[model samples]
Target: MRASRLRRAFAVAAAAGAMVFSVAGTSGSAASGMPAAPRLPGVQADTLAERYGANDDFIEKSERAARRMGDTARADHLAELAEPGRQFLSFDPRDDGLAVEVLGDLAHADRVAVVVPGSDTTIDTFDELGTRYAALAGGARAVHAEMRRLSPDTKVAVVAWLGYHAPRTLSRDVVTTARAQAGGAQLRVFVAQLKQANPAAPVTLICHSYGSAVCGSAVENPASTAAPLDNLAGIAVVGSPGMGLRSASDLAVRVPLWVGRGADDWIAGVPHASVSVPGATIGFGTDPLSREFGARTFDAGRGGHSDYFKPGGLALHNLALIGLGHGEAVSHD
Candidate 1:
């Protein structure tokens, strides 16, 4: 059984690697003969509509450039993403990467949820406009909808943050925390800037899969003197392999730490261990949902790996509960 799992892991990784190359290769602005997107407005904007307008203008320019370069598919894609009312905090046509969008009114939000996605999440696959289960953007919208459904009076916002270069499942990079380290720094800075703009709004980070490693890295390193992420109100890691830490204590954060995993998630089969490679340590250590690791485990239901944010699913419900500072109210298995 152990050998079979290892074989499956490698097979999945290989398949993931090839697909990623094809998708990511399409994102190069110079290679595609498209100009770079303009610099985005301040991400920490107090007026949500104003920020959306600025980003929309840049998206339109980039889309026009793509069309001029004869890449109509990309141009069309950008047009859909730039639809007038959508709230985009940033836009970069470089790697088709790191576009942040708010699902609700960020300006008056009492609570905010920042979604950190896992592997295979590029801008191309990040926003499949109408499909709810296929993309991170869909999941973020679902979460926002659920929050509104459950608590109509509460003003909440969900940020779909494709803020890092996610690794392919089959690549060697996936085995290491290297990418997570860089992503974590960016996330930390983003959260800090968020606090600066909305001092009264509490923030919760919803990390999925390898994105948990990014969240973990952003907090105290234990080995370093860097301060912990005290600005966050809470953090929830779902379908996590591990957080690049043996225990939650290693994160050194003051907020409540939550963990959950779906019963059918293939990640449950991956051995929860970390090893040192030539240049980096591969794999995150320790199962986060394990009692020994000490996270508040919540119910994620019987969905598969990518089903956590399903509109009416228990996982999404629990996530909404946690994001609203009702962690204790979250249902468990």
Candidate 2:
């Protein structure tokens, strides 16, 4: 009886989300006429400089294409990305776009944090001032900066990874696991690449909101053809809906998992349950912050969903500690 009621509730929620948010339009501009980017470089510490140069060239070309297409906003944004000091491991200004930006010296860093953003994240909105997705880049910068402040002698790097077509928050897609599954696969591949580049560095996935679902999928489903991610130090999720699993033990990897939710986060209202339907799962199950999930919980203060990475915030400080493998120092809820 309980299971039946849960399924019915999921169906209603899914239908409501579709009716309210599924607009009859594409997510973003396709950037169809943009020039092709250079081939991504092989994952190697020695090729870091070469990869940055190639991505820089691609950014310049993309900037020109955006200008030609009369998209001043996009062109201006690309121009900033192409600046001399900025470094990007990868850039693709097509479709919703994908980019992996490094904030510190990745080649020399022994600890690395890969920041995965949630819904509504795209190239155009990467660092846009008013959007919630702005936290994607902002959070990465905050984590990087906080890590430096916490342990200046330690070598750490933060990578802002916008590598998937994130679903819109109001859309039906956000309620399903399809996007998360695909993103998880991509994340797995990217982590493999990261390991290949620097085998000694311990990588931690810092996921936010929907991105936590992606990380959950990534850790839950390892590629059959690829080796396991042995260098994964930990995973930290903030403002999450759910991780598509019943419990932390369900995770395929046995790494340390940590979760934090802001005191006033709207996500706390989301139903933490999943129900199987005809073609897909309707929700992500098991709230990471719940005692039943069996993951460490952290104090996120009184901010809302988008404030986890706010400078000097408790959440940001704990995130840095987790990413740096100093889990003992994170403040619990």
Candidate 3:
């Protein structure tokens, strides 16, 4: 139950079989100087299902998981989360294995949050993100419900993007090497799918831990030949070491980037970690507020890494604020 144990368990699992989906970082291919991905124009929500056809398996899986939860409200909430499947990316079963779940009416929502969860994350664990083996409807679902409960009237969409191949160790195999290249390519394509679902809808890329690494790499080193998509309203990274860029301005999206780390995050204590990342070459001692990195630094109190998105956690509250365009004012204990 210790943080170190949890982090280690995840590392072992990922190194073995992709860790299902780590709520943590991967050793990106960027560490070794591999080129990023080719950019694809984003997709609109309306025609996504008709265009891509990537949602059947995900929809069936989510529905089955919801029924087993034994909680109607959660089942409904999960159903809501998976609703986005009908809107974006066509639920491509063969497409890089990225998972998608949507809550609220994507066609009408003013603000949308695409949640890219970190290590040990998976499509089936859509609700819990590896909290417990029997957690069919645990952690992720609870907070997702809280999001709706806090503001049912607000047309907010919660996406559990458990897709993308993550690293097994803190090594460069998945993260720096493959994830950096393949992740950006998939994301580029996904963004196009999302835009097709709903154009001009403000997108807030909410990334966690290793997911942050994916986000940074996607933006900093976009595909060599493609034009960039529309600006994301915002980018939020919690419990992050640093996005792959030397500074936030380096990100291609031309959006405001924000970062926070739960005070107790053991990742901050890991020495020579990011510095070890090869190509993108981010080193340790990365300050979220470094002017060199154009992001706004958020002070996320002492919740530790995994605790960032937990109920009543300061980081989660911050995420809600970022989600609502309310800025980072709310603070949870």
Each model's lDDT: 0.79, 0.84, 0.55
Ranking by TM-score: 2, 1, 3
- lDDT for model 2, on a 0 to 1 scale? 0.84
Model 2 pairs whose backbones collide: none
- 124-222: candidate 1 lDDT, tens digit per residue: 677772365547888888888888888999999899998888886667567678999888888887787677657778989999999999998887454
Lowest lDDT 10-mer window, candidate 2? 21-30
Q: Which residue runs of candidate 2 sit more than 4 Å off their true CA positions?
A: 1-30, 129-134, 221-223
Q: For model 2, what is the error of residue 45's alpha carbon versus the real structure, in angstroms, after optimal superposition?
A: 0.5
**How well does candidate 2 match the true structure in TM-score terms?**
0.92
Model 2 lDDT, residue 177, Cα: 92
Maximum-TM-score candidate: 2
Q: What's the best-to-worst order under lDDT?
A: 2, 1, 3
Q: Please give the lDDT score at residue 26 for candidate 2.
A: 38
lDDT of 2 at 240: 95
lDDT of 1 at 236: 90
